[model samples]
Target: MKKLVSMALALSLCLAMFAGCGGTPSSSSTVSSGPSSSSEDTSTSGFENKELNIAIFEGGYGPEYWEEIVDRFEETYGVTVNMQISPTIGDIIRPQIVAGNVPDFISMNDNDTTGLISSMIRENALLDITDVFEGPGLEDTSPLKEQVLEGVLNTAKCSPYSDGKVYLAPFNASPMGLVYNKTLFEENGWELPETWDEFFALGDKAKEKGIALFTYAGIHPGYMESLLWPAIASAAGIDTTTDISNYVEGSFSSPEVMEVLANIQKIAADGYLMEGTVALNHTQSQTDMMMNKALFIPNGNWMEGEMKDAPRADGFEFGMTTAPSLNAGDQRYVMTSVEQFSIPAGAKNPELAKEFLRFLYTEESVKLFAEKAGGIYALKNATEWSKDYVTEGVYSMNDVYNMGDSMVFGFAALPEGSKVTPRDEVFQSVADVMNGAMTPEQWAEKVEASFTEVSNMAK
Candidate 1:
């Protein structure tokens, strides 16, 4: 929470909407409050009671935190709260959307595999929550806009499609990069690398000691993008980086992209990654790091909490740093991954849903979320109020901001009908390149073709 990145820096990046891949709807539950409300006040039944329905994506963090919050909201407003929760909430809610029975409020975690948010965004099924931000906070009269940290509300995550219209509200703030064992480095007297040369040199030394230089949550190749994108931005410059996200023609074939692919190739060709890593799940690869089978892993701050119960080498301490600069003196940019919230355009109680979202952004509610769920608000200049709830290993995220400027690669909505997403393609090619199935040139070419295809569709 110290040395937080300024909002000014956050606004400089090009933000875009992310489209979700469509899939069959999953199982779900519907809890309703005995019915009736076409108005904000009393229902047609002439009852003074208000009712609201919310659906939450149940991820590793679970839904208890939100259930408690809903309890408080219900207590305060004397309303009946209906809850629909599931790990597959996105898939579960898709059919509901089709049936014209959308929940009043919803939170689809960033890790949702079903891509529900993206699908909804692509269909323009989400309400533009711009007015919610401009309105007052639930706890106070000040405009919610003023209460937000600078740049937090301006990013692509909030205004997907870059139309200056906010459909998603920022939820959790996560800094991602290279996570390693500090104790291993200290015990071996290896200084953290700050440049590519130093990084490779250390990798070589690590390899000699029977430790692979790098590994990732291979099952989730998407995670490795965090590690690779910053390196690309640092070497290529921000303009080229922006072009990549915007699907600019020939962006993938740029010299900067080639550099990124080449570096990745070098790692693969050099035999630097852990053996059999391309098949590992997130936790399995993370376990490799915990057990010292691999020296480092590309992960977010959540790794610490996610791996808290796993075994670790004695004196092991989690430490995170930005990817080494492309060369000495290059500007390093750390990536921040954010979780988001939104209301459906068809939400029956849009007013109540907006009020609930505003409450979530309030100082007290934010603190409660951090305390109960170990989540920090995405607001800039936010502090570590939930420090006690967070494990020490995750605290390494703080070191990243203190070290340099930070930027997030905002999720871009791929043009609909594209067979594959640029990210999915990048990840697939990365696997092929790492495994020697594709040459760096081939990878670059594939990516370029995908970029051109998406660009053409956008036109």
Candidate 2:
């Protein structure tokens, strides 16, 4: 990935964690030989030989409540799950793979690769799941695998293959949305805004009382798209995936795109964005919001979990919504992605890993993930949040669903190597505009320049 990144730009790739959420009880600290220690093995007998050795990343994305699913799988299969949990996922896997001691399974993919699974496939380091996902077992376990909203499969399948022969199953998904301080909005008698103008208008109102309108990390590439960038693309009607293609490099430099860019600049110029936003990490920005230092932030819907324990005297309530539209005509939809999980091709026990993944996708897992971790589940029985501003998000989507998924996926489905568009660079533009160094048109040109550089590199 030819990032516009240098030491100057930063991002929190794991949106599920830093954006305020808890995860699995990873076994990074506990040392074990193989399938002898993970939550997937509580029993000493029965399906003992069905033990699975899993190479999972510790912390961040794991669910603290995931042990129940692991225990269930062990009870049913009588297998011990040896979890090789590591804080640095790539570092942990690279050495083991080089030594040919590939674990039985890998938990998920990270952004620090040239799409590792595909590269591994070409390098012969991964297993081909063309047979597994196509196998009948998927239907028996997760019917939603078939009914999953379109983008879900893309995350599991990765690039170089989109015809389903999936190498991974989705364990959780974090669709980006507006995370607001429900208490803040209520105390001020503000309903969650339904349109972009309304959203900005609320910012003015909040500003009068010392609140920044919305927050986004202009520093990180992953969180950039994971939050505000797609909403910007949607505002411009650029179809993010299309703009991300090398075929049309000016996708984000059009007049429509600049207007969206201008709105961002306008917000900053009007003192709606928080001070020092450019220097803050995604975690810090959200923490600032949890502390009532900002009024709203563009964040994954899973953001609620991370702030559930905030010290708000009124127990801060958070809500989700698609980014308000550029105008009433653009569209009202949130940017979201598949956020799927996959097993590395180099795993030692692909079958056992598959079974374990199936167990994690159960209804029980869905509830724990949604209620405690604050994720919006793609499962059939997923709960609908009913209190405060969260309820507004659930009910508002029915009308907005008509706007369609493409509205939010423009940048999401972009091709590899296309670094320009709205990623973190958009935020840089936001900062520049606030500093009186660039106009929206100038910002758009700079974005065009970034895209041009990557496009030329591709050629």
Candidate 3:
């Protein structure tokens, strides 16, 4: 239920939080590179041993897509899977878990509620899936294990401080990339930005040309929030993954972080950003920008496909960029995360949960999850995924695309905080500064407050 940070910037909060894992990949984007085709009959997945009630996520790849396959899992194991769709979903499904009402499998991991699993593990509510990745008693999961993308696997393993083990198996990968309006850039004699200064200077030019440069989902902030990590890392010269993921309160309020907000404010004040951005979600903002009335929109590559249908007359060519820093010498990160999945400890069948966890990593399952979800697969050696818009976007280091710095997770404005607080409180703290109701200092204070209130959850 927690919102995902951005990855190649794949995966979403079903439709709430969306994000993928870090860094702009090199010219040759990483994908299926480990194991090749499989000739195994993984048809049943050995789930026939239990009656599984799966609470599939809303807006996630539906059970319909894999129902037949799960049926095979059921048939081979002489079991039945009663798919229970989660009409109500988010980072934590504690109410259902507490009431003793739980599906066998529930797919939602954003590290926001990863605490739930950690807590569940304390009570033995879930199984330790270390075996899922480092196989011993498991079947030949090579194909499936190979299917999971690296970034996706990292996001899947984003949890820290667990006792030398894992509780989740990523089913797919989703990275974050900057989605740009290509034709507008070409029409205006603009090229995709390769550095941080280009990003802001172009805003000045685009403003003069009456173009609303970048509009993003401020109300629904996950991947959008994650974008700040690299932006700050690039600006602050911080790169250690440990600092990126779990840094303290004032860490994000530093000058580097302040500077990025200052630029965003400058862009907004200069009228380079779309109007009503504060009121808009990711889709709406993309709609306005792709309509070509607005020039550029900051979004995960997921928005790339949505804009593909925009009339070319409006000049909607798709391109991506990594968010920028103050200068070129700064250390950079792709600032990405994934929408991950895990089974609760209270799950009816921990062994069955372990089996389904294995099923999710299979080549067929990972590939199927990717094809339907449109992101990278989560694995040590993820499959090559350049064909799709989402996959292509994450590999922003390509010739056609480039980045300002390496990608990072985040320090400021995490998706988990947004899930705990009302989106309005989360966004208005930033909006208030842009609107001049709060200065950067006061805004920083308020931002910390909004975040600290949510941090209480981790405690």
Best by lDDT: 1
**Residues forming the 10-long window of minimal summed lDDT in candidate 2:** 1-10
lDDT of 3 by residue, 366-442 (tens): 44444544445555434443244234433442322234433424222234323443233434566665555766667
lDDT (Cα) of model 1: 0.71
Score every model by TM-score. Answer: 0.85, 0.72, 0.73
Candidate 1 lDDT, 326-427, residue by residue in tens: 778888878877778889889998887876786566555555565555556776434555554555555656678776567767656677766656666677
Q: What TM-score does candidate 3 reach?
A: 0.73
lDDT of candidate 2 vs native?
0.53
Ranking by lDDT: 1, 2, 3
User: For residues 1-459, could you state the per-residue lDDT of candidate 2 as single tens digits?
Assistant: 101111122123222222213552212222121232333333343446666766554334444444444545555566676554433454555655667767666655333332444345435455555544444332234354453445555442343233445555544444566666667777889876766688788888887878788666645425554435555556665455455432246777766666666676776787787888767866778888777778767766445444444455355765555666666666555565444455666666776766666555544455554433334454434434212112233333333344434333422322344444334455545667766688888876776777766557556
Per-candidate Cα lDDT values, in order, are 0.71, 0.53, 0.52
